[model samples]
Target: MRATSIGAVLSGALVLSASAVTAPAAYAAETGVVIQKVSVNGGKPIVLGTSQTESFTISVTASDDSGISSKLAFLQIKREVGDNYWSYHGTPTCTASSATTSTCKLTFKLDSGWGVPRNTLAGPWKVVVQLQSKDGDLYNNGGDITHPVLRRGKLSVDAGPEPVAKGKSLRVTGKLSRANWDKRTYAGYTNQPVKLQFRKAGTSTYTTVKTVNTNSTGNLSTTVTASADGYWRWSFAGTSTTSAVNAAGDYVDVR
Candidate 1:
């Protein structure tokens, strides 16, 4: 059987993307999974502030030539740092928001008891959907089941204080966090540099005002004198082990 071996990893293990689906790929002819997007707290880049609990919704699409051996289908989250381990944290039962041979979608949450641990390590991690063989399926010449292709995924960020008073000091705060496969919680990314940016209400461009660093708890906080009403946010440049992220814009009123 001609198949690409993923090695001695667990039968629960599998290999790796974005845009709600992988951009596209070259082939091995084995039916595999595509991770459209893995949202942290319902956002990307998995940014949190001094928080341990979270919600994760993994949008997955999958297929297989052997009618999609549905029983072994599951989503796994893997962290790069620490144990660098991977596991299934989605749910015990398989319930698709939608399903077809060419597509399958599932959404689960951490608090719902379907996500990673409450104290999982935070950083860039892999969100995988495993499309494995079923009871009636046949192996390729007795070879190990193959994982055809895999791509990478993006991180997430969340910014706030929807409106700030003008001329008054605006307190901007957020968390630097990412997926932790071991514990399944989106944990803080402590002691990292994050740039604060602003855009006036009349302008479309944002300029960097100052840089703030995360504390021991991965909390980001800073104050900027209010001037013109516009938007404010934080941007993490990202290291080799993590992906870059820009927080959502918070509108401020300088009145």
Candidate 2:
């Protein structure tokens, strides 16, 4: 049988934006079918950078006494209640695990040019799924799943005074930034905590020296006493809307 896309089946679907709604777990309407599991991007947040498109797969595992239907499923990741979403326009491929259970999967692509809103927030978005059983039982959820989308972060660090007298003061400087989907550029990620780390020469591990917060322009700076030759770098733990980042180590010489 021909299958209808979830977006088509629920033309007036009213799932709210991630920022506005907290949806409950999806449950089948009848006892004939049960949705056992759902996974998006392998349960990892969808992260976007300046120019590359992200491709992810969604899988839905369901079971029914009457067996599952083949190639009759749809998946949608909605940014809002309306037409703004990443959808799998084709039929999902269903692989049966047992006579009564099957897992349906589909792939989707998200890029800057996909007609999605340029101002879409980098937090939780909703996942909507639809499926049918061979016995005619159907399952359609109203944004029952939540997934995160985040901006990719970048960090830079520079330790000044390449050669310094032992026990002298050394300076470290850096910047923290993240991808701005709307502008397609890297913009400063201000007022975030960043760790300044140091590794003694001949050592393979780095230890945190101090924590500094970025300024209004996402610039970071700090002072430390030079003890030994080593490398310096900055590390950001990341926030809900941004991905974690680390700057390359900058070498310093203490004479």
The top-ranked prediction according to lDDT is: 2
Best model per TM-score: 2
User: What is the TM-score (0 to 1) of candidate 2?
Assistant: 0.78
Question: In model 2, what is the error at residue 54, expressed in angstroms?
Answer: 2.1
Candidate 2 structure quality by residue, lDDT tens digits, 146-217: 777667788888887879888999889988888887788888888999999998999999899899999999
lDDT of each: 0.48, 0.71
lDDT of 2: 0.71
- How do the residues 1-255 of candidate 1 rate in per-residue lDDT, one tens digit apiece? 011111011111222223234423322233333333333223343332222344445444444433444565555554543654434344323334344233434544435553443333443355555554432432121111112111111222333343546566777777776544444445677888988888888899989999988988777788878878777777766653344566666776666
Spell out the clash pairs found in candidate 2: none
How well does candidate 1 match the true structure in TM-score terms?
A: 0.45
Q: Which parts of model 2 have CA positions greater than 4 angstroms off?
A: 1-31, 81-90, 111-117, 201-205
